[model samples]
Target chain A: MSTTATAIDNKKGLWRGGVSPFKASYGKLMMWFFLLSDAFTFSTLLVTYAFIRWSAPAYKGEASDFVFSTEYWPIPEKVYEAFPGFHGVELPLVFVGLMTFILIMSSVTMVLAVEAGHRMDRKSVVKWMLWTIIGGIAFLGCQAWEWTHFINGTEAGTIGDVVKNGLWINNYEIHGANLTFNQYGPPAFAALFFFITGFHGFHVFSGVVINVIIFFNSATGMYERRGHYEMIEKVGLYWHFVDLVWVFVFTFFYLI
Target chain B: MEQVSNVVVQPADRKKIWGIWKVALILFIVTSIEYVFAFTMSKGMLLNVIFVTLTIVKATYIVSEFMHLGHEIKSLMYSIILPMLFIVWLIVSLVNIEGAAIKGARGTQDFTGSNGATEQVDEGH
Candidate 1:
């Protein structure tokens, strides 16, 4: 007869009727689905890359080390050595390491943002979210720089007695990357590199855009009106998922 | 930082924040270990095992801590992780079959031009 009695009457069995199977909100469940699907897409790309590399003929340098090989799959270490600003320095994997650090730090900030959101602390959430967006943008910029350097190789090629494109040490054509030519090693290498990293970059870019929206909403006290910060937590889940995929991508594509 | 120290914050909340930071530190250390091994270790079964093992370790931490899956109900967690096993199956089967085919084809013919004349096992550069 009373409101409390009515509320208690509405309660159903744990496993049927109106109960949530996973104890997760509808939006959060949907986010998990999105992330799972995204995970499949990325893993497929990476595994296909592995399969293709497996299929390719081995390239061993005269020293027989894959690191300095001029043939076969170009050496992973040799091809990715160009650091930003210091043009000719042979700093292998340093740039990538820096990028990894950036992504990891961004992920950390995202969790912090979600933590702030839990307390209904609008200012803290905004601050942490802004840092995350900045980190994402910086990552995209770094990827652009990496792609530019890779497509327009610095490895010089020597023909007979003359040195053509003195820094052209890579296998693909100099200038930029494309469908047919990749200075790195095999055409497939550049293609996969482009497709995979580009896909991840696009995710980060979209995340930044969404972050801005949430940042705006949080600034305007939208969640405050709703009496919850679940939205921020949901987006935080997505952000961290992106970061997780990058860990796999970095390991498979670069570190391996 | 100062705001986090406000009197309104509970000690339990502070502990949770510190726990997150601890996991972050662990992630950093593991990644650094991966980097060091990448250069020092050669490509082989052992190295591959190490890399895969380390990757799983990193993934566990991320899923458990950052995603808060560690606190999730068993049904929810299993539903998310159990299905990913199929992907691993795909990786193993495809790489094995494809790699074998490539090796067979390679033995019968050489398409790498002059580099094809070199020995199968190369020394370091």
Candidate 2:
């Protein structure tokens, strides 16, 4: 009779109040809390980007004049304008568009994985997570290509002769035989770009690692034994956060 | 134990998937509009307002639907968004301060024919 009463009490406790389907273990809850804090960190960085862009001195010259391949602060589109096999043509924002699509598709795959988890379909979960990881790798590859293009000036002309206006004019030269303020608008721009993107990329890399581990576990039926796929759901939250951050990056860093 | 079984047995309406898809479609449409506006419109005061508005709309959908913040308790919602208000306040104040500093520097440069050091020395020891 005592055991029956205890069982009844446990049952009553389960739904006495509103309960969340996502109420998992403590580790999962803590992960959500940590992600909330991390979200604030990224927001601070992006807000700082807005502040700096607003505070910078505006030059009357055209954006192409003072951007990449010159001694001026890079115009984002010019710096990231790579499109394979269409060499020597200045097509703006093509690569960024591709990167955005990759990220969105990865996000779609992540949702599919989460849906599979809800259905307790381990095979589907693993399959979709693999696709999501592939999407992440593709994005990282695109970023690497972008970084390379940025470091090595395009064939428009040699590096030092480029001016603030995307023109490869002959007169402009890096003072003191090295590129400095005269070539780039300010050192802060490049420094911030590398730091922010590098930090975000690091997050993506870590996310992929976590996803792979989860995939392996699911494939081995570890989660099935545990009777839930909450781990996948927790990781999905992290993946979505990464995608959210990239949307901001696309808008602020690329389009703006 | 009984209530746990009941909760598990309660079938979630599969129609919720359609609602999720609707939210996603709205987000995509808004983002596409933002892209179009950005590419076609010249940068100016009006464009800035429009872009910021559209961005907020997209952010709203992501936060509410994708993040599931809408399903959360009202207090939790306030806790998250209230801090963001403070961030917005800080951004506004800092931008104003920086703007003032730049204006002051430019004024000194225009009047003194130098970057303000001579004026400082003349007024000081």
Candidate 3:
């Protein structure tokens, strides 16, 4: 009878308000909740993007026949084809692919740092954190370059039946994309591009700042003195969340 | 204070480290596949389906392995994931009906006049 009472007490103890039912540290649990909210925010953004893209009329004809026009949605491949140094050379998806690779590599490095932290290896954590920071900066640099290219309209030649002003005016030169107008297609395309990628970029920027702070904290043996490195794990979760969001952004924006 | 003391920090092991690299490798491979498809395949529903599926695959690996959610308690994991299902539902329903309504209202082909000759005037502009 005493054993039964104890078992009942044990089962009830989970909800007795003294124990953590989830078995997660308070900070970590709060971080997860924060991340969950963030996921909803990103979801709304991407869903809006998808809705807009879907509502736009699909481009018809061969991929090679695609030209900038108000009449149809622009082919993503044709619009995003310009390579930085190679300028006019059409290298579709390569640069964005490189950006994706950079973000993923940084994410891996962050995981390594967290892993090292688990072992209480402050030296390894600092080293890996440094690499993660470098990777984050590199990605931001590439995004900056890409944005510059986007703003500065490409060389103005009407490539095969490009339309302007809702009429096929002769000598219609292509202007770079802005929120007001997009030489690519509808103005909404450029607007969404700016909003979505800009928002994601801002997240990356803030993540790098936080990462730097944590890197210093680890390097100076703050966690070491505390006898734990849970801080790294929490920050690592944030870093990985950034990467996860990028995976979706890359797919919806570039690949699809 | 006692709850805080209960926080357990698992030490790193070789197997777990290997698992991280394996996930990274999978992500790299999936992205490469996406690139190949982007160039080779014609734009259509089939291609979009493929890309979306592959993207989910990549997202799963990142969330499960990199974020370490898969190793967490089942309730914690479900608490995070179950809410996201609403997002999926939102995408499926909203994008389908609203997107079609928008396309119908705007009628790009009808409004802009795809042919060079038709001087169709759009009053909304």
TM accuracy, model 1: 0.85
lDDT of 1 by residue, B28-94 (tens): 9999999899888766568777877888888889888888888889988988898777887787678
lDDT of 2 by residue, A134-181 (tens): 999999988877765655544443334333565445545443112322
Best-to-worst TM-score order: 3, 1, 2
Give lDDT: candidate 1, residue A90.
Answer: 78
* lDDT of each candidate versus the true structure: 0.75, 0.65, 0.82
Instruction: Please tell me the TM-score of chain B in candidate 2 relative to the true structure's chain B.
Output: 0.66
Candidate 2 lands at a TM-score of 0.76
The DockQ scores of all candidates, in the order shown, are 0.32, 0.15, 0.42
| TM-score versus the correct structure, for each prediction | 0.85, 0.76, 0.87
Instruction: Give me the displacement of residue A119 in model 3, in angstroms.
Output: 0.5
lDDT (C-alpha) at residue B115 in model 2: 30
Q: In candidate 1, how many clashes are counted?
A: 12
lDDT of 1: 0.75
Per-residue lDDT tens digits for candidate 3, residues A76-141, read: 777777777897888987888889999999999999998888877777899999999999999999
- Lowest lDDT 10-residue stretch of candidate 3 chain B: B1-10
Error of 2 at A75 (Å): 4.0
